[model samples]
Target: THARAHLPAAGAAAMDVAESPDLQAQLAAAVHALNHASHPSARLAANQWLLGLQRSPHAWALAVSLLASADHPSPSADLLFFAAQMLRRKIQSPDYSLPDNAAQLLDALLVAARRFCLAPPRLLTQICLALAALALRAEGGVDGLFARMPHLPDPALLELLTVLPEEVAQDESGDTGVDSATRCRFARELLMHAPAVLEFLLAQSEKPAAADGVPLHERNHRILRCLLSWVRAGCFSGAPASALAAHPLLTFAFNSLQAFFSFEVAIEVMTELVSQYQELPQAFLSKMPYIREVLLLPALANRSEKIIAGLTSLMCEVGQAAPGLVAEGSNEALSLSDALLRCVAFSSEDWEIAESTLQFWCSLAHCILGIDEQTSKRNATQELFLPVFSSLLDALLFRAQIIDIDEHCTGRVSSIPDGLVQFRLNLEELLVDICLLLGAPAYINKVCLFC
Candidate 1:
């Protein structure tokens, strides 16, 4: 093929396979040897050969051909995955380029991603990643690159959107070879695209079910996951709290929690938003009443351990994010605190869910006892929390009573389980904080009872 003749030689001594078939055969043999070779030296040689192949200009075209090939029988999954991976690397390489062939490369990636959208998600992910890298590296950014990609199926498009923010986040963190200036520019472009992306997600989520029969819950879960990736990437930074609060995506996330399939991701989305309270106080504040009424409070009463654990962590997130709220003794704060108290004191041998509240308790103790100029305010704060601290101390003491376990069950006869030891250490730190607040002698007497 004329394409092989035009392939830029990798180096002075790099071997050149003369045709597509020859190159494909060489890559397959190398992959097999690297995976299945019995001898160390043969495997090492294959690894070296494949690494050398990646550096060749031919690798760019070869990867695309392997990914998009339909003329021959379908390639092995390993070869296809390698091809997708290679395409991503080539796009990411600062020194790698096909100045005039970028459009062709982008089209080829979309084709490959579309072909493999149903299964073996890893290959599809790599193809999407390659497209994302190209978008960052291309001239007009996401809009331009995606503008060229007008006909992708919904699943492929969603997958691409899902990976775009993740790729941008990964790149902005300095893992990619692209220079800081380029990554910064790309990130700004992505943030610029956030509104449109959110709109896209809302539109997709509102469709009762996809034309292709993707379940409503699954679609919403993916949409929420994409929103989370963007939020973590700082795409929503400086957006108005009111605007974010009113966004359909936020509403959709809240709504998703009612459905079992989407509940876990929905909790994560809510937790992330709650965590951003310091940055978007009004946004999270506006939702706090709803969160307490519809989500946290109700979830706390449920008997499912998973629900209890998730909502407990979320409640703690709110408490830690706004220790002052806990100090102020708002009805909302009091209610969430009551929920946390139940978590700590809930009857269970495993302290894992209870342990989630330790940091919040420690933060509250700090708030109650930290140096304050207003003696009256300090007293009021201490007065409000003293009983809560005392109750918590009692729960900790009750929880600390040692219990015998079958030696074989833990696989250690002498040493305490690491989990138990860590739980006790954390409890000790919180106990000291409680001791300062409730009076040392009272704390000592409480421990004496446990002793």
Candidate 2:
């Protein structure tokens, strides 16, 4: 009569009296009080009760029962999310040990997760975190967990893989109650599986969206996020920079930028790709056309400010990633520097997009200054970058000038916006770098002329 069917033997030891018939009634009441209670105090009491249950010896059984109850008509999303969350918390608790019933628990979780494949993503995310935590703490590690993941419905499975790397990396910070030794072991295990993860992601990317009833763009977005997560976890760190540059996932992410729906995530993926793998000459070379295409978007003038800002930010990363290329004045470099200069020339009110390019300019300035006067490339690089920085200096000065509002009110200069003031400070730092490239005395003479 006990709700002990899904409870592992290890977790069952202390559940005899805790699994009474009244347990279900108590749980239902507490859930209702937490969700629909009229009074704040009632909800608080219910929350405290649930927290106590999370730490109870019978918590595993209770959560399993709640998750398995999805077969009943109209199961509560709150219940499913709460159960999944509780499992994750328990697994990450310092006092927790690997339950003898872990495999059984995994099976139960997989089943429960599949039942709610189309559930709210928060619930799916929690379930995935729980599975990830379980995988990290148990015997077989991520390889075994990944081997069993195919049984999940497509969305559920993707969500699981997506969260696995992120959770493992987060646990390495020691916030998950996993000791450093175990964390290091799990990290090693995760690295061994990285290749498999890459292959799996590539395969998933090739699958049509219709196969899983999820939209193609949505599926690809998830794949992009998974790629980003893996990159952040250093899964690809061991790969040669050229191989990473040519990776199919990175190519897919680049292609994703062409779409309206996937544009934001695609920018993020590309930005991370270039920023982290700056040494990828092959990758940057291959991506030149795409980079050029983004800057020349015919409808760019019609796009929203946020989209333009995102594009500008991505270009800034591109500029910093290959400052050498920019100094070499390759057509690609010139095109990129042109785009950045245009961003700097944006209306004074739109200072943020302008502000974003300051670092890129400063970087170009340093790249130019670092050139040896004895080298033949030195003068050529200065000639290439001179106009670019000069145009930027002019733009910064224009941005700094306070509006007089009217010639009649010339002495009463309008108050400079705080954003512009901060932007000017940033401009000063870049000005120093620029002055280093073009003699400081020349810069002072130019300023004196403006005065």
Candidate 3:
């Protein structure tokens, strides 16, 4: 009787399986059996069956709960990966909203993340990525996910950063098979909303002895670059930059820049700084002397034309914000003017560099002229602006000679011809502007000598 009863329910019950309470009970039994079964194949089959039933929320919650339990110490890697995939799908699903138990689930995942750090690096990275995704989604749904994760200690946060670069590299290389759009979305979310996480990363960079075999400087630089990228990406949105600036994390960034002056990092950080705070230049000049020598100068004297253009725009920000300070030998203005003259005089083989250099000179001249007219130190201002203008015109003359030499040797007259035309036009315009501003023929004549 028992065998026959299990074989087929006969009559109406068997025919109406969809509505049968017995059938529902049978399916629940199967799901629970699969979840607890000792056999790996049985667990996989159970998950597949649950997925087929579209038990998204229930399956995800169970997976998260299983991960949270210390007794469930070592779930199969396949099971964990599938769980992560399901969670990701749930996040992407339009119909899915944060579950009532989301905060509990997130809390569980944070615990799991800490545990996963004790696992191998490959597994550790995957778990960290999954937890980051969950946290990011929780952020979007919950008003304050950070506040909710009050128990998430700094150790867990630092562990996440430890594996972040691996995850990023995998995602970037399509190793994780995550799409670019999704990766970018995750990065932007983490960067904008997770200030504490970023701060944690910055703090980790400061403690060389605490780092687990990773070079402190290399780690610090990479972390700094990553945060800078996030800030730049969110510039139009305004939220990320403002959030970062308001956080204590910025102190780490500022201190890191002060410790090391890589041309690349400096340019990136400085550009973001100026974009976020128009007054940042004055602040930097007042506090960070090293920033002037390393980052600001190389940027102004960058041989790359595109870099020079960006540097010029940055200098313009400096000039516009504090004309009086800039003209009065403020570290930034003096260093910038010197760099521009050197770049103009030396990097003349590239026509574009020469052109940018001249344009930068004009901007500097304009700023100086403005300061001279408005300030009490008229003589000192004239003295500063005059030498800079003379140096610029001399650079222009030097460039013309070099171009003529190249033209004479290579018979590339056309290459040099356009530059010469532009040079003359700029020189004439600069002279006229200076004459008008200075109200003196001698200043015009001094500029004319080099032209």
lDDT of all predictions, in order shown? 0.75, 0.75, 0.53
Evaluated at residue 12, the lDDT of candidate 3 is 43
- Candidate 2 per-residue lDDT, tens place, 1-451, comes to 1122232453544454334558866877888899999999999999999998876768887777777773556447776677788888887676656467788878878887898788888998888888888887788867778777767887888888788777656644656466667767877777787888788889889996667888888888888888887777778786787677778888888777777788888888778777777676435544555655654354256645666777788888877887777788877777777776766766645479888888888887888888898887898888777777777777777776765355576777666678878877878788898887767876776667656
Candidate 3 vs. truth: CA RMSD? Answer: 12.7
Q: How accurate is candidate 2 locally (lDDT)?
A: 0.75
Residue 73 lDDT in candidate 3: 40
Where in model 2 is the C-alpha error above 4 Å?
1-21, 171-176, 294-299, 348-350, 374-376, 401-416, 440-451
Global lDDT of model 3: 0.53
Q: Which tens-of-lDDT digit does each residue in 317-396 have in candidate 3? A: 45555556666775556776665555566554445555655544555556666653555676677776666666665666
lDDT of 2 at 35: 92
Cα lDDT, model 2, residue 345: 68
Could you estimate the TM-score for every candidate? 0.83, 0.87, 0.51
Model 1 accuracy (lDDT, Cα) = 0.75
Give the number of the best model, judged by TM-score: 2
Find the 10 residues in a row with the least total lDDT in model 2. 1-10
State the lDDT at 367 in candidate 1.
Answer: 82
Residues 1-451 of candidate 1 have per-residue lDDT tens digits of: 0121244533322223423587789998988888889999999999999889887777876777677677557888888888888878776765555435577677778888778877577787888888998888777757776675557777777888888877655644555455668767777877887777777878888786765567677777778888888787676688776776777787888778778788888878878887864644334544556655676556666656777787677778777888876788766666666667777876565779888899999998888788483788988878878888888898877766557656576655576667667788888789889999989898888889877
